[model samples]
Target: MENCKQEFEEVDVVFSKTKHLTKEECTKLQLQDSRLVSEFQASKLEIDAKKNWDLFYKRNETRFFKDRRWTTREFKELVNGGKSCSGKVLMEIGCGVGNLIFPLLEEEPNIFVHACDLSPRAIEFVKNHPSFSSDKINAFVCDITTDEITRQLELSCVDVVTLIFVLSAIHPQKFAICLENIYKLLKPGGIVLFRDYGLYDMAQLRFKAGHKISENFYMRQDGTRSYYFSIEFLRDLFTGAGFNIICNDYVHRRTINKKENLDVPRIFVQGKFQKPS
Candidate 1:
């Protein structure tokens, strides 16, 4: 058993090798063309964000994203010693196809989940899933930017809110409003767990010249928008909303495809912010 454990550790070490880039290198890699926005296209994308997301779900169904299995390891408070959560409440803000929530439910059956998404189709998929229990999971449609979240959930009741790759989808101008709504939904001591694209990530650098919508934001060919964030910007946004940062850092990983001869570095900014008691 000890030898097997050692072998696994060595494998992990080999795969975890990452290459860090300097600021100059990253700047040079970003879309070098002028960041210009076409008013017509910008307006269309903003208005059709929901429509685009709905189409995305209709086309991909529930299979596009892999289940996130790292939550339990990253946020230990979600489960207690491989057992149940003892009934902590969690809200997943872009709960697509029950990925994070379902895995978490499997781990801690006693915990309750409030899952919301802007796409009704995504919520429908979650509700129809075989493991979905109406008693334990409340699946609803909510637009954090415009909807009154309190109407859907009791104010100051959530214990933890997970925002995994959700914020990057919204327009940067509305980020503050979205964060403010999330702030009101959490209890005085509630925590917000965040993980999203970091500035100059490979995905960001790959955008073509015409796709740049604004500084660090772009629209993909699919009509969905993505915004890359810097740690300082995220800290300011969360702190301005009255949350105290518990932990904030960039998570860097390198993926190597030997067959394709490709080595890609991915950077993601993750944070845990607590609403002060």
Candidate 2:
């Protein structure tokens, strides 16, 4: 029957309303009454973005974000879509403390990696990491929105580019420029693997109106910023950047920590886009 088929049909994500952390104080405030960040403060946050992220690593080096071992599984393109991975060039944008970089090397040792971040401290952490090697990785400091990665890397040389949880920190208006830079670094047929916050994610919903910098973008308490993306927006972004979208969809998962008594739903949009061969 139609009803039975619908019930048992495979689904990519089970849609749910945005959730709230049960004990978060922000939930108590009404959006209308809460104040948005002032223009001066917003500008200061943007200007001081690097300093804030550096301080973030200074305060919690190699502790804030854990090793992302799930990257390979989530983005098959990282491992060459099950093909040979030998001699491939991988560039991880916003590679904080080499968390993802080191683990990726351990899992697939044949590929070379170029890891860069806006925070010099973060890049230092990567260079100082025991697994880091000049032969294996070239870690550097770069603010992709303004800096030219081509100076360090030959244009169109990279086979895969990973933008994981990085773009959300940048101003939305600069997204096109940022993607353009990334596009120039990839081989003609190379792919970009992207995963970032999704619109109405719990983290987005957790912010009080006072933290808002713009629609769907907010300033965190620590001075860093976050922007949530809709699937439609991502499609438009990548396609408009001249990429052929392989897949783009919302991924929903829950972060569970029994010791902390935490179970929070998280939403993210992930996609793979390739340049024309």
> Could you say which candidate leads in lDDT?
2
Error of 2 at 111 (Å): 0.8
Candidate 2 residue-wise lDDT, 60-125, digit = tens? 998889899989988887776778899999999999999888988888889999999999999999
Please provide the root mean square deviation of candidate 2 (C-alpha atoms, Å). 6.4
- The list of candidate 2 runs beyond 4 A from truth reads 1-34, 256-262
lDDT of 1 by residue, 1-277 (tens): 0243322211111112223667866675564455556979999999999899999999999989999987787777678557657768899999988999999888788889999999999999999999999999999988989746878888898999999999999999999999899999999999999989887778887776688888888889899999998888998999999999998777775665555666667777888999999
Q: For model 1, name the residue pairs that clash.
A: none
Which TM-score value belongs to model 2?
0.87
Q: How many clashes in each candidate?
A: 0, 0
Please give the lDDT score at residue 76 for candidate 2.
Answer: 80
**Model 1 accuracy (lDDT, Cα):** 0.84
